[model samples]
Target chain A: MAAPPGPESIALLERFVAALKAQGVVTEEEIAEQIARTDRASPEIGARMVARAWTDPAYRELLLRDGSAAAEQMGVSMAGAPPLGVLEDTDTLHHLVVCTLCSCYPRMVLGYPPHWYKSAAYRARAVRDPRGVLAEWGTVLPDGMELRVVDSTADYRWMVLPQRPAGTEGWDETRLASLVTRDALVGVTLPMVAERAAA
Target chain B: MQDDAPPPATHDLGGAPRFRCTPVEPDDAAPPDAFGKRVDALRQLLARKGLMSVDELRRGVEAIPEAEYHALGYYERWLRSISGIMVEKGVVPAEALKP
Candidate 1:
């Protein structure tokens, strides 16, 4: 079993969790479970969404316009919470999403979030310097992509359906799915390889 | 089994037979009781003089978990709470924000 959090952090999180409840963010069990379900890999479900957006133009455009609606096109539903929307990253403006205030994720699509995701460090840093945050995640932005950070709050929520990187023109859906990294889906990480190499 | 659902009246004004939120208050403002519930405790503390609007602050309540927002085991309970608060607070509009 993993070690438990220190008392100071737990106390803070408890108060944090309680505050979120008052704002109508997340609940006790959901918070507990979300904290419990922390993992290294991003949700396989979000990866599938990224893959679908890659080869399908209609789907990609749809995802950019209405994420929740577009997700439904691929069988992922954000119906549990409020009307959630999806946001996409383009060449001129790269989009990165964070609750800033809380961890209001598309829980249905991304599954439970990581512990770091909801951390005050992340919340404060993400808004302050997205490029720095991405760098910490090991993503070095390309020469000319302007990074725009968006705070996903109670009013609006977002998901990043990153553009298919320059490679693997003929790759099938299964092959494409592997290329979609968790970071790419969340907008913090990127698909490093041009295409899925000979793996 | 698909037919198992609470009656529509028990739900929101949408009349779609969804889950219900905890009866905390008039539902116009963020309920004070949510403070002790879950993630909301923090938000309740941080909601300073002009940090945020009632709508934004209310959706911030979503920072909390679902059970405190709506009746447990009621599918779409979370949706009701988030959308309901936003709608009631005029953040998204009644028709557009209806859960």
Candidate 2:
């Protein structure tokens, strides 16, 4: 566990909260609700959306067209977040999303970003050498496949629509979602095909 | 306010070859602690109140020294930016933050 905040920090926090109350910036209930909203965010929401998109072309189109609305259809809330941009990956092209400045991300969908996603190495190298960065994450693309790096700036957040892996033809959405990891949605990895031999 | 280093553009990190390429593995998901929760709450409240824009917060966070930036955790950076902006706007006195 991380160390507790120092006495000075606690005092500062008290003063900060008091100032907010005094200035009518927010009510206690409102702050609680905001925190609760963040609490409700989870990566499963993204996994489910990706699974459904793989099953239904219409939903895939909708997801690509309006990510927030598509998320709302599945009972996910994108409140207080910038517009979501779902990058579609095709057989010939790949997409990787990064926020080169700081870790601006689609928190509403993917919950908190992984620690490495916020690392300076990722922020700098992702833009400098996307293919190499993805390779470091164990993702390699075939030759001649175009890799597009989309920087999610202050005004927008992005996620990758990873291409459905081959050989998962007759699987249910739940089973397919099991293969979608958070890294896949971030464009670092692709969904793996379930091994029948393990079963 | 000008120095030898390039002008302050936080989001202009694309194609900058100065940084080393060492991908750190992500840690397991941990629930927010008291400090992180408070910082997140304060950020939402400040934004809702129109006292601090996201752009302003980004500027403040990016203005942090690179070494400290790398040393601080994700939400820790938010707290640093919050503290800096609050003091700069005179919402909270700097003396109150003195350790």
Candidates' lDDT values, in order? 0.53, 0.79
| Model 1 per-residue lDDT tens digits across residues A156-195 | 6677877777766898887778887655666877775543
CAPRI band of model 2? Answer: acceptable
How well does candidate 2 score on lDDT at residue A139? 79
RMSD of 2: 3.7
TM-score of chain B of 2: 0.73
TM-score, candidate 1, is 0.55
Error of 2 at A29 (Å): 5.2
lDDT of 1: 0.53
- The parts of candidate 1 lying over 4 Å away from their true place are A1-42, A194-199, B1-99
Question: How close is chain B to the truth by TM-score, in each candidate?
Answer: 0.26, 0.73
lDDT tens string, model 2, A42-137? 778899999999999999999999999999899876776799989999999988888887777888889877667766677888877888788776
Score residue A193 of candidate 1 by CA lDDT. 57
